[model samples]
Target: MVASTGHEPCELGPIDYLVIELPQGTTTLTEQMTDQIIRSVSDRTLRILELLIVERDGAGDLTVTEFEELTDRGLRGLDASLVEILAGEDVHNLASAIAPGRCAVVIVWEYLTATSFTAAVRASGATLVAQGRIPAQAIAATLRGDDEDA
Candidate 1:
């Protein structure tokens, strides 16, 4: 769901999506977290494609809110493309991951650091074979000598 950012050459990095659950009873992002995000976007580490809030009620019903309308979220300058990259099924799965009566923020971002490398690889006619991410928990478990997950 990468939309044009109206930038020339359009050499984009890897796109990534994340879901961060808000602590129960809290909807506002912490100042420290906000600062880090601002720094990352400002320094071109990432480009935001979409940002939305999902809330699951006690009855397990789901509701979504666009980040722009949530002025209290403290992400004023940061703008999302609001392209709705996540399909309905994906949103459903994300909602299922949230505990009842809680909320979470869904972020879709492009990794700017790999842009030039990807462009160079393409220029050399190299094709991407495959890509994947290893969960941090798996690394932690392996380091702790937990063979079950290893």
Candidate 2:
């Protein structure tokens, strides 16, 4: 038997990507962050669909590594299955933006908490048209009345 959502089941939530840059002199993905990622996936708060690490050499060459390659470099607590969702184009595009002599860890994940709500809205014939994120710096400036200084 197969489970269904009355309508076709979708992954049903916002899929978002994050690029975390490590300035020169930083070495590897931290073990603490790896453990947090493991905890989130185990408890279903988030589903990591793709993980890519891009490194830019001082000469501006880029190297892209997928999940397994990252594991070899000490990114623990990740399952090999997540590599299946890697979007080559996505990784390449993000890699192109990295500054020389820096490294960036890119994770594409689904917000599991919003999944059921998304499904219900879809079933009701509603659709999400737009969404945006406000930078924390902007929020802080507003609260500090620093806008006047700008």
Candidate 3:
């Protein structure tokens, strides 16, 4: 059996999550990164589906803080709430991965769907064969002319 959304399917781009650790003594997100997200969303390059900050104490206990709570708790300049992004279990899993005495900023975003391009591909009967990502380290090494054979 397959599940559906009770509506027609829509073209969607890739979704990815990044976990950025705030080192000890750092409590808030940097303005630079916030501006980047704002710029991307404004330009229609990507959409932030969910954003969260999870803190872990010295005893490895997780403190779950909702994105909306941050707005109330003084996470300045951020005024959006994505309350229904991920399931509770998913949130827990992300929090569990955080190291003690640190907090993680998790951003789940999707590249804006290329609606016309996808439609054109479908009309041309071109089916997706495979999809994968090359690690950034490999790309960096290739760009730097570093030998990857060893």
Candidate 4:
């Protein structure tokens, strides 16, 4: 069951979420990154289901804002307006992982490339039971046999 929502079993594609943190006072959302995202959306490679931002102040106070809110706060360079699809619980959950004095961009996206496979699975009455992500650092450490550090 989806958190904070009623028991409505909706058919969803291979959706995934990511929380990307930027260092304090860092502005890494360059024009190139924006262009790449626009291209992907235009090509139907993926769809931005949700977009949220979390900012942690020096005193460790957290502030969660939606896409439009962020744009209103002098972040008006993006060419797209993402939907506010995340629930309150989702914002809190993603915010909990971010560090103090840092900023994080939480995005929930659907992988269009997996549409056919997901459709097939749904047709067979096989629902996705579970899913998890292993961070890139962990994968690299395991591949290099750096178990101690990992």
- Report RMSD (Å) for each prediction in the order shown: 2.7, 4.3, 4.0, 4.5
Show where candidate 4 strays beyond 4 Å.
1-11, 72-81
lDDT of 1: 0.78
What clash pairs does model 1 have?
Answer: none
Whose lDDT is greatest here?
A: 1
Q: Which stretches of candidate 3 lie over 4 Å from their true place?
A: 1-5, 72-83, 113-115, 122-126, 148-150
Judged by TM-score relative to the true structure, which candidate is superior, 1 or 2? Answer: 1
- Per-residue lDDT over 7-31 for candidate 4, one digit per residue giving the tens place of the 0 to 100 score: 7554455678888897578634445
Worst 10 residues of 2 by lDDT: 72-81
Q: How high a TM-score does candidate 4 get? A: 0.74
TM-score of 2: 0.78
Which pairs in model 2 have colliding backbones? Answer: none
Better of 1 and 2 by lDDT: 1
**C-alpha lDDT (0 to 100) for residue 134 of candidate 1:** 86
The regions of model 2 sitting more than 4 angstroms off are 1-8, 72-77, 80-86, 148-150
Ranking by TM-score: 1, 2, 3, 4
User: What range of 10 consecutive residues in model 4 has the weakest lDDT sum?
Assistant: 70-79
- Residue 28 of model 2: what lDDT? 54
Candidate 1 lDDT over 1-150, as tens digits, reads 123657745667888888888998977566786788778888989877777788999999988887767765557767643456788788878778889999888888888899889888878888778888889999999999998986
